[model samples]
Target: MDNTIFAQSIARIRSLETKMIDKAKIEAMVESRDFNDCLRFLQDTQYGSYITASNYEEGLKSATIDIYKEMYKICPLREVVDILALRYDSHNIKSLIKGKLAGIDTLYLTVDAGTIPVDRLNIMVKEENFRDMPKTLRYYVEKAFENYKNSQDPQDIDITIDKGIYEYMLEIAESSKMEYLLDIVKLMIDTINIKSFIRINIQERGRDFMQKVLLPKGNLDKDLFLNNITDSLESFANKIMHTDYFKWVKEGLGEYIKKGDLGSIEKYGDNYIIDYLKKAKLVSFGPDPIIAYILARENEIRAIRIILTGKRNDVSPDIIRERLRDVYV
Candidate 1:
């Protein structure tokens, strides 16, 4: 985890980052006159070949898969890549399961960035056979099915799979024995829990609902959320001031309470993680830069989708801007 094993992969990723979608490019896309104009903005970057006026979604998914393929080839430790790919795998599991139960197409929501190929995963979910899937993911897939059967709730599929995603992430971090990876995973869990907490309160759900949604073993204690079930979001934000999330939670709550902007909380959380990942630039050689590059690409893909969707729907630039996540520098 702390060696020059990742030197080659980091070098390739460093060069790629330069060609990445920058802030100026993002602004051009956002301020574009229409959806076609936004497509023009991406045409000059790495996304040029894959994107078009009508099928930006396909391009985005392709770009995501291409990066994972490149990283898998260059990265010395495949597990490092697996840690990032696991998120996509979990996403596919959730989408496919829900789609199967509802008897509809959810392929558009699936990304090819997972460790398993998209076609194979779709088939696996269709046939209800995951024996060939990754062990951690397979177990979660089975559990999700059971949870859904018991509750007859499609939301159970999402929640169970979401929990599984982080569980597998934490396991990867712990097994890798990298303090950096472990800490990032913990912060992410804390962030997810916080978002869930906010959503339940915003929806006026009960503490019993909170108990079912919260994940296990983040840096923050579960009681911090359970005990604060009755407090306002503002009060809860004030309480977490001494924790690592003090700054964003405080600032984000302002927009949330005053304007009912839930996106602010999410934007601040993404910014927080990107700011944390910025430190990896100082590490001459390690897995840090590799993971940082992966997430940076993910952030870039999300921004592209946001701007294009906003353009298509004629949404305001200011409102769209609020929905965007922080760019990796």
Candidate 2:
């Protein structure tokens, strides 16, 4: 069966992922809160202590490198690697185009969404190799950049970029053979659409503006979202309640649509993805270190960023905690 190749590929990927996980635990010990334990772990793991003498942030770089180095030790599944590579490539493309359009310095944008190199990103953007990038990223860079170049409005650029990303992600997910991956992608699209709708319409913007910003993705019909929002939030919720996903947003939020309890929609979707993969890992064995683990780490990084930013701004931990997403252990 043709699936044999996929099965074999998965087996190799699993072996690699397990190796990385073990190595990562050792690295984590080096990064432990206890100073002496951390030092001992560092020595044991041979994670180099060469950090910038002038900046505390350099320690973060060193620690992150150790984490990823361990991850590399486990070996990644080809499909997992490809998916991540394409996602990061798309991000860099978006950053380049948006930075140019908004007149923001490229340095202000983050470089570490995945393993994308600055040199490769430079070449891709400089050459405008949208066609050569990846199927997952090609249409997004092209359409978003075209729209941004034509309009030059910051809001338009933001919306265009989001819409382009969602549309492209939806296309790929729909075509993908992996059921779990496709489900997660569709859920992500649903969340994006929901957020965009709320931000544009319920936030008092025009329906036309909402439509312009929304990506045409997911199982939900675009016209339904746009038309439903013309009524109250309850009506919209009720309309969605008929769908398979209605329970996710409706059960906890049905009573408080007026109070913005829906801000957690993104968090819920992210947690669901992580949880789904954690369960999948029990049944499957492959090189891909379960999408849940990756998403959880990503969420952890995001939470750390939010906390650090809040600290810098003197925002209370309470406020930061509210904004934090779920993390995997």
Q: In terms of lDDT, which candidate is strongest?
A: 1
lDDT of 2 at 217: 59
lDDT of each: 0.86, 0.54
Looking at model 1, report the run of 10 residues with the lowest lDDT sum: 1-10
Question: Tens digit of lDDT per residue, candidate 1, span 42-108?
Answer: 7788899988877778888888899899989988888788888988888888899999999999988
Backbone clash pairs for candidate 1 read none
Scored against the true structure, residue 64 in model 2 reaches a CA lDDT of: 46
User: Candidates' TM-scores?
Assistant: 0.95, 0.70
Question: Distance from true position, residue 292, model 2, in Å?
Answer: 1.3
After superposing candidate 1, which stretches have Cα over 4 Å from the reference?
none
